[model samples]
Target: MKTGDQTPLICYQEMTRASWRQFRPTTDGHVAAVSVDRRSQLALMDRRPSPSEIYYRPPAGVYWVDVSVHHAMLHLELPTAEGVFAFRAAIDVAWRISDPVRAVKDGVKLCEPIYRPFLERKLRDMSQEFEVGSFADAERHINTYFADRAVDLPSGVAMVRCIVKLAPEDSARNHIQQRTFDRHKAERRNAEHKAHLHGAELQHDWNTTAHGLAMQSLAHGQETAAVEQRHREELEQQRIAHYTSALQTGGIGVLALQLASSPADVSEVVQIMLHQKQLDLESARDVLNTLMEQRLITRRDVQDVMAPISKVIADRLNPTASLAHREPLPELAAPPVGPVGQVEESEGLDEDESDHD
Candidate 1:
């Protein structure tokens, strides 16, 4: 009540403040702790409590109370390689009126200047340093920046668990992923190139080996043919030598025949000479023995004629020469007679055939 009816000096208003409508009336002029919105000073009584916000108001007044109690969440954004990185800081503000009366005279001491968090201002200084790194590197940098250090807030507040994250757009994540894919692709290409070269080298070696085998096979065939030709030549030479030996033996037989027919006991001598030497001598010896048993010539007469023939042959031959190397007998100039003797042994022969045999 005022004194009587003198001029009334009133200060408190009855109308409600848009921001302070829900704030419970406090007794007297005692200072209280309450939250005021940045836009309209909406007290914590009316505004819904944010997930990370806390407030305490024992009494409603224009000044901060002596008790220090405040909590706030600070959000900041900075550009990064993975896009905007949102950093968070949780602050426990220690606020109070060191001088209650002076705080009232000074208005709200825990307003924007004191208890409010200037997170963007702090991050603005660090934006240039926080570059967008690689995919995981960006996340690591954000985590490390907050995890490794403490943060200070307004009103002498210390941050509790500061959390930091990178909120990238789809494009940013795609860019990082694309770079990773390109690196893997390059490595794979290099591996493929090396394998291709190795395959080429292996193919070249195979071709070279195959060519060598072919040449070796051809050379072997040619050598075999050459060996066979050499063997044939050797066989021909042997055959010629054998034929020449046979001819020499026949010549000796003919010479003996000519000697035997020399107008006396010549034919009988030739017959004996032909009978004496043959390849194996079995058949020829049989015939000679048969002729002798038939008394074609007396043994004494045969020995007389053969002894002179042997002496003549021995004089014609070289004494030092081996028999195998001896010259054949010379050709005889006798007329071609139908038969050398009238013995029945050669009676079936034709004229020319008898002479040759």
Candidate 2:
């Protein structure tokens, strides 16, 4: 027998009803031979094969048929869950003649057409369960369904093993790409909004904290100023109390000692005291004449008294004097006196003396 590059089911010869036909096995000897009796159809109905040997020969009045396994790649557009979109599948199928008589009686010329239609119908039904985007799952399902499972193929072809590769069509792929882009864009926008909200909250918190600190600093400053003001007031009160006590307890002498820094101030204080006492030149002369007449105080005794009083006043008023921090004056045998004759009466006292008599 001779084999060419024809299809799996090959017709070597077709004879008339009265003539006889003879054939031999294929060169590869792997192909099955069938005898088809077209008039009575006995061979095809009873599933009979013609004798195929280099030494044997087929009967006459029979059609000679050769059946062999064929490997083919079937490309199909299978329907999916999306009505408009479909999956493109490439199926690698290895099929063979299951019933050779049936192949010849049905006039099956090619094994691919026999099982491809059946596979397409079955795969389309299976693919409708998934969307186009689920190409990988669809591929796995197809391979699993056709793995070692018997498929009812037409015209005596049987499926051996089917390796399927599934993918989305061009339009469906573009649709998936556009949908993914939109989803990512939406997610990015949402993330940016959340970041903006987070930033705003942080800024608000910072402002609040800054405001509170500023208020606290201001309050502290005010409190410090108030404390300083109270301290100054307390110091002023202490000074006033000190001056008042000096005036009440120590009299003009202590006041002079405390305030008088020079002999001129001491003299002014003495004049002010004499004026308050209402003493004029005449009263001073009379007091001196009485003291002279009674001989209780002499001129030299008065001078001696005046001299000590002047020295004491000068020493009390002088800051550098040894007795600067001492008592204002010592107790005297007589009243406080200054240089009466040396003290000239002012013009006002002269006028007052003229009015005295």
Candidate number achieving the greatest lDDT relative to the actual structure: 2
Name the regions of candidate 1 deviating beyond 4 angstroms.
Answer: 1-76, 80-133, 151-155, 177-199, 223-357
Each candidate's number of clashing pairs is 4, 1
**Candidate 1 per-residue C-alpha lDDT over 20-133 given as tens digits, one digit per residue, 9 for 90 to 100:** 445454544333434433342434222333333324322223223432333334444455432454323232222233333334344433433643435445444454354443
TM per candidate: 0.35, 0.48
Q: Who wins the TM-score comparison? A: 2
Number of clashing residue pairs, candidate 2: 1
The digit string of per-residue lDDT tens for model 2 on 228-341 reads 999989976764565567544646566655455444444444334334333443355467656655646644456655566456544434423443553343321233344354
- Each model's C-alpha lDDT? 0.44, 0.63
Worst 10 residues of 2 by lDDT: 45-54
- Model 1 lDDT on a 0 to 1 scale: 0.44
